[model samples]
Target chain A: EAGVVQSPRYKIIEKKQPVAFWCNPISGHNTLYWYLQNLGQGPELLIRYENEEAVDDSQLPKDRFSAERLKGVDSTLKIQPAELGDSAVYLCASSLQGQETQYFGPGTRLLVL
Target chain B: GIQVEQSPPDLILQEGANSTLRCNFSDSVNNLQWFHQNPWGQLINLFYIPSGTKQNGRLSATTVATERYSLLYISSSQTTDSGVYFCAVDEYGNKLVFGAGTILRVKS
Candidate 1:
């Protein structure tokens, strides 16, 4: 079976520039999540969505980071005016509705100069 | 909020040897998963043992949710096993709280 898929596996932008990452989850999966991982660290949850509704986004930085799963099958995570600290891997994962083992995609590595 | 702690922040083992990695959580969890982040930066799901024991090839995992701990055992390790291993838990939703991973390097 095809796992979660993410685009632009690597991105580099100047500080204060906006960047976006896209993800397409495995077929039939209903839960999607975005996570941020610094070097040598485990991923930290940024937001989680159940279908079209964002159920948990407390960890997301609203001022700069915004995410949407408009169609419920695919998701997009955006960072506006990204800072140097935002230079990290943006990971996308998916699972069955409610709760299930998540399958992750090859993350997009963002580098802000 | 939940706290997850992994033991032996770093481990080094020779090929064909055995090793154990542990995870301890601060509170009750509804689900638990083990992941291996390979050199290419892909998070590979190793096991989803919220409780009980499971084995796959040279690897096995046991989760004692009541005791708030889980263990991953690698038997006859190989150099390809090098990477970081992470433990994540969720109490309310699939959103996980992750622990700092344990870095393992298996040498030939």
Candidate 2:
């Protein structure tokens, strides 16, 4: 079976520009998550979706970050007016309903200058 | 919110050496996992052992839920095992709290 897939494995943008990352979870997985990982640190959850409904997004920076999981399969996370601190890896993961083992994608590395 | 801490932030070993990584959590949890972030930046799930012990190939992990700690054992390590190992736990079974991670380098 195919694992989770993400688009634009790498991206570079100037500060204040808008950027977006897309993700497609594994087949039949009903739970999806978006995480941000900085240099020398573990990933931190930004948002989580349960079949199109965002159940946990408290860690997301609503001031400039927004995410959507339409139809409950694919998800897109966007950052408006990107900042230097936003330069990091954006990872997408998915798991079966109520299952804790999450399968991750290759991830999108964004570099904001 | 729960806190996760990993000890020996960095470790270097020869290809044939063995090592143990530890992870400690502040609160009780029912969901715990170990992940390896490769040099190419892929997060690979190594184990989903919230309790008990599990072994796969040269790697084994044991989680003692009662003590709020987990151990990852890498025996006869290979150069390919160089990367950062992360331990994450979820108290509510949804959102995971991750440790700072342990960086390991296996020399050839």
Candidate 3:
């Protein structure tokens, strides 16, 4: 089966610009997650969705970052007026409900100048 | 929140050599996973070993849940095996806490 898919593998924007990343989870997977990875560091959870409900988003920066999984199969993470610190790799992963194994996409590399 | 620590932080090996990576966690966990992030930034699942041992080709992993530690073994390493290896644990069964990761460089 195909793995999780993400769009616009690489994006570049100036500081204070708006940017968005999209993700498509694997088939039949009921749990989707978004993570941010800085250089030389492991990924940190940003948001998680169980079906269409966001079960965890405490780590997300609500002031500038927002995410939604409307139909439950696809998700979009947005950053409005992104800051220079917002430059990082945005990764999307999915797994079957109740399963701990998660598969990740190639990730979207964002660079804010 | 739980703490995860990885040892060595970096490893360098020549082709055909073998090496081991270690991960130590601070609390009990329901799920543990090993992942390899390629130079292109794609995370590939290496193993989902919550307990016991599992082997796949040249790679193998063992997790001692009771001890709150895991080990990943790579045998006869190749240049392609060079990447960052991460150990992640889910204490509540949903959120994963990851270690800083071990950077591996296999020179051919």
Candidate 4:
């Protein structure tokens, strides 16, 4: 089976510009997650979706960051007026509902100048 | 929130050598996973061992849930094994808390 897929593997934008990343989960997977990874650090959860409902988004920056999984199979994470500090890798992962194992996609590398 | 710690922040080994990486958690967890992040930043699942041991080719992992620790072993390491190894734990089942990760560089 194909693994999770993400679009625009790399993105570059100027500070204060709007940017968006997309993710497509594996077939039959009901849980999807978005994470941010800084250089020399492990990934931190930004948002999590179970089907079409966002079960966890406490770590997400509500002021400038927003995410949605409209049809439940695909998700989009957006950053409005991106800041210089927003430069990092945005990763998407998926797994079966109630299952512990998660598979990750090749992440979108964002560079804000 | 739970704490996860990985030892030997970095390691360098010649090809054909063996090494082990360790991860210690602060509390009991329902799930534990090991991942290898390649140079291109793709996270490849290595193991989903919450307890007991599992092996796949030259790699193996063991998780002792009761002890709150896990170990990943790389046998006869290859240059392809060069990457960052991360250990993540889930206390509530969905949210994963990850360690800083161990950077491995295998020389050919």
lDDT of 4 by residue, A87-106 (tens): 99999999999788899999
C-alpha lDDT of candidate 1 relative to the true structure: 0.93
lDDT per residue for candidate 3 within B2-22, as digits (tens), equals 999998799999999999999
> Interface RMSD of the predictions, in order shown?
0.7, 0.6, 0.6, 0.6
Q: Per-residue lDDT tens digits of candidate 4, residues B1-108?
A: 899999889999999999999999999998899999998899998998889999999999999898899999999999999999999999985899999999999999
Candidate 3 residue lDDT tens string, A56-112: 999999999999999889999999999999999999999999888899999999999
Q: What is the number of backbone collisions in each predicted candidate, taken in the order shown?
A: 0, 0, 0, 0
Which regions of candidate 4 deviate over 4 angstroms?
none
DockQ of 3: 0.91
Stretches of candidate 1 off by over 4 Å are none
Residue B101 CA displacement from its true place in model 2, Å: 0.8
State the weakest 10-residue window (summed lDDT) of model 1 chain B.
B89-98
User: What's model 2's lDDT at A69?
Assistant: 93
- A20-69 per-residue lDDT for model 1 (tens digits): 99999999998998999999789999998889999899999999999999
**Top of the candidates by DockQ:** 4
| Per-model RMSD to reference | 0.9, 0.7, 0.8, 0.8
TM-score of candidate 1 versus the correct structure, residues matched by position: 0.97
The candidate 2 chain B region of ten consecutive residues with least summed lDDT is B89-98
Predicted candidate 2 versus true structure: per-residue lDDT over A1-113, tens digit per residue: 99999989999999999999999999999999999999999899999999999999999999999999999999999999899999999999999998889999999999999
Candidate 2 lDDT, tens digit per residue, B1-108? Answer: 899999889999999999999999999998999999999999899999999999999999999999999999999999999999999999995788899999999999
TM-score (C-alpha) between model 4 and the true structure? 0.98
